[model samples]
Target: MAILILLTTQLRAWSQGEPPYITLLQGDSIYVGNSIALQDTVFYDVLLKPTIEKTLSVYNIISLRINEFDTKVIPDSFQVHVKVRIYYADSANAQDSIDEKTLTVTYNKFSTYEGKAILRLRGAHWVQVKVLEVTADYATLSAVLPVVELENRMVINRDFYMDEEDDAITTISKDTTTLEDCQELKVYWTPSQVAEMYDLEWTFIDSSAINAGWYNTGGVKDPVKIFRNNASRVRISSDQYLIPLLYDGKGALYYRVRAVQEKENGEILYTVWSDLGDHRFTGHETNLNWQATTTFAEEGKRKSVVQYFDGSLRGRQTVTRDNTTKTTLVAETLYDKQGRPVIQVLPAPTLSQLIAYTPLFNVEDETKEYHKGVYDTLSGSSQYCSQTSVPFSPASGAANYYSASNPAAEEKEFQYIPESNGYAFVQT
Candidate 1:
């Protein structure tokens, strides 16, 4: 890799009064393809590890510029051509002409002239600038060309295990399995040339929505990092029950890997983070217990009621009519004692008595009957009622049924279904 230094120092003679030559100005040495450094030189030549055997190394000339020089007599025009020849390290007779390109430079006396070169391919070879021709008088040329070396890229692979058996990896196209069965995870990557260390990090996501605030906001912890001692693989185990049980039911775990290369001179280079690998963990067997309250306007009064239930049973009900409120608990008929269900009974108020004092008790008075017996006093005739004679009822029966106060708390029993990984209401 050639270092580009911006011309800050005054122009100095390359040789005593031999027309000060121009060289590389300011620029950093760039790694070719990989993140490792195998050799160190002022301008090091990079050796690319080809994916296939018997392949040639490819080179690209990113940017070229003329550095320091005396601008007394500006050259009208100058031509630059790169000559690259490849030869086997074992035999000099095995030589081949790989690349040759002639570039025209727009010369400026006071400022630098930027030029671009076409890509070239050569197998373990040497590169040199051959001045094809110079067009102006007293137009001497001095050039500085940097050689860039590309590094070998790395790839990561992952596998999962449960106990001593290897678990089949789950993918988007594959069916999801329970996480309770998995106890270990392994992540590995192909070793990169010039890489001295590797860094791994991972995090867990509880839902599909990405919480940017969870990662960006203060007080949030960073992802867990695991360093490897130049090893190509790492294993993580939750055998001791280190993995926390997810109360939210299910979640996904994501991980990233990167290679780190440090030069002997204390210079550090890092590869970008690899693509994210995600694993979904299911089989959250915890019971859910919650209560919901609903409120509605009735007879110029706001009425509210609450219903509570657990995973296996409906537990209680509470009702509020205006300022008065009442609660009824549905006693469990059976209790689990050491896996044995024992029968028990506790006396509690019935549903009718609980709402008797509330506005719900007057629901029947507010309801209207649509059908009526027709008897005209003026005509003194008995007949079926017409639409006009029929009592008008605003579909009040359905609404009144829900509004009626009940003290006997209803109970619903749910059975867990392993195939669906959920519960179903079996009896109410």
Candidate 2:
């Protein structure tokens, strides 16, 4: 992709022997469907990938500025048109030649600042760039150049096994069983806890290749935006493409899905796939278990689901109450010949269940000491940002302790959960 260095570096160049001047301005979000308002305007393009495709290649964006003193027209308001020629340059060098992504930019213009995502640099040097777009906000006086190839990408695909127990009885049979209709999707990846630019891609494929296009977890449908700054709409394919998400032995990937099967005649059917009311308790109060039942309100453009710890616990209350907090967990002491606290890790919640489900743990108030052991630093490292109300420690508390649920910068309080191998918790 032909990315613009919208963020300019201080470079002095004399063109007509006058005082040298240069300015750079980057572009903002470029959305889909005919138009997505942008912070800048420039050449743009996109790569369309089919569902279930494991690998994804890049695209390009290119633009030519028209000077006012010379061309005498505002680029943003004028007839702005771009012609792109794509090429695959293995070398970051400007001298190499390669395959093309898009030969011509088709039906492109900006309604706002920057309206495009990828551009192609043709003729001189076809360099594949993966970042930063040029918008009308940029100084047209400054000369524009092709972006250089910066890095490589290993497209990681995330897969999760799901079963809708609530719909089990509605199924015709075992193989012809009914499952929760999917709505929103949450991808949780651990990027090896390293610092790297991860391009996330999200595609929910049903029986074969049909993508699940419906309301996100937050419930907003129209103007559904996918951009860099949006945590929910990760620029990459899936949120959980990193190490921990693949086969971490923890709560595997879980996507909040909502499905709506519409009839040609106009009747709307709400499948188990709907996420219109998925929520958790947000108040300070807790359920019978220490776990909070009321969840926080949806924040930002995206709503995500993360598996904080290995066990996505589910403690079914044989009873119910508004104030389930301060209740104690009852368990008969059962142990092997050796005397020890008996415990084993519980299975995680399913995608269908998690959308409307709250994590249920059996930890008593006394066992609350585990929160202290949680070490905010360690717990923060692996959280799903969009799924979590937590936040990373700007203090650089190191990896394993990153918390996406920091209350200081967030609207909700997320309980820190740490993972263990054999059991969800161990007794002293």
Candidate 3:
């Protein structure tokens, strides 16, 4: 009898060819084939036959019964049982043991179907259902919906980060990284395609001052302390950042920037930092008294001295000495508060001591020849003293010359001579 039953099952499998591919429709969702996991109680099923066109559509009314719940359609004396396996760690060995439970399903009236369908599954982790028999008046159906327990799994999401090609600022070079004067240092950057603003970070590493030739001969080093206080100043797109008044021009500065975006609901997002840029610093202070001394090699024994008072050039003196003749020419200029030269002291004249005044000349001899006096012919040591008028004031004139004998004489007052276009300085 077992041999006869195996022969009959083989013949049935051969006649059926492949398993039936059915489509279950529940509202807008469609489930296909025998691998369907039941979601709603009511759905329509369509039997798809495998032909040359694979186009045969045969509708069969399927009634599924599993998980202690059934559809609204009343089955003709139908019963269902679910095979459940609960796994637990085995105390005797390293394998897991299974506990089996056989439970019968009950019919419920919560389903409303437009057409005939079968799927009465609920509360099963891993279930596979199969239908056995069906009829008209006395329909007898047999199905197995196996429920198996599975291990829990955790999922992680991977993020896509930015690359160096999307950096916002240009590379640091000699032309862009030198800080020489008291002017504000401006750092420019390219705009990011995805960012609305940017966050800036900087640090200054104290090092030796740059040489007078504007060369950063001082060695560069890594920064030990970072200035995060400036990072809070988030800037909008394409805006140039001016370094704050925090540097004293005694060292080098390092900067790195990143992109930032803000959502409509006030959520901020940040990106990774860009490459670090190094900038060398020279003197940029303004409020202190300073002096500069320079010696020239081409001009023999030439030296220039410049003095500044309250950030303004106060005095400048150039000395040129002839080492062979033991003579020196000292020309100096003194400036007022407005940076205009107030006094210009000229070099003393080196005139010959012999004079051409003839003491024996007759008092009325018209033809007697007498050379010009040495004092009258030679230029004297004089200082050109100037008084600059105040801004928008009415007076102006030429500078006054004071001889060495009357070196203490004050500047002569002058008037503003009105011209066709503007006022001219007229010495009175």
Answer with 1 or 2, whichever has the higher TM-score: 1
Predictions: Cα RMSD each: 26.8, 22.7, 35.6
Which has the better TM-score: candidate 1, or candidate 3?
3
lDDT of 3 by residue, 1-428 (tens): 00000001011111111123333322112112212322111111222111112211111112322322333345524333333332221112232323333333333345532121222221222222222222221232312222111111111111112233453444422234323321225576665534546666565555542223232323433222334332223344544554532344477666667777554466677776666666666543334444534343321222333333433435444333332243333444444434566444343212111111112121112342212221012334452233322211111111111121223233343123212111111112
- Tell me the lDDT of candidate 3: 0.33
Off by over 4 Å in 1: 1-182, 211-248, 283-428
Task: State the displacement of the C-alpha of residue 30, model 2, in Å, after optimal TM-score superposition.
Answer: 18
Roughly what TM-score does model 1 have, to 2 decimal places? 0.21
Task: Return the candidate ranking by lDDT, descending.
Answer: 3, 1, 2
Model 2 spans > 4 angstroms off? 1-76, 79-87, 90-114, 117-428
Q: Estimate the TM-score of every prediction.
A: 0.21, 0.18, 0.26
User: What's model 2's lDDT at 1?
Assistant: 29
Top-scoring candidate (lDDT): 3
In the predicted model 3, the residue pairs found to clash are: none
The candidates, ranked best first by TM-score, are 3, 1, 2
Instruction: Determine which window of 10 residues in candidate 3 has minimal summed lDDT.
Output: 1-10
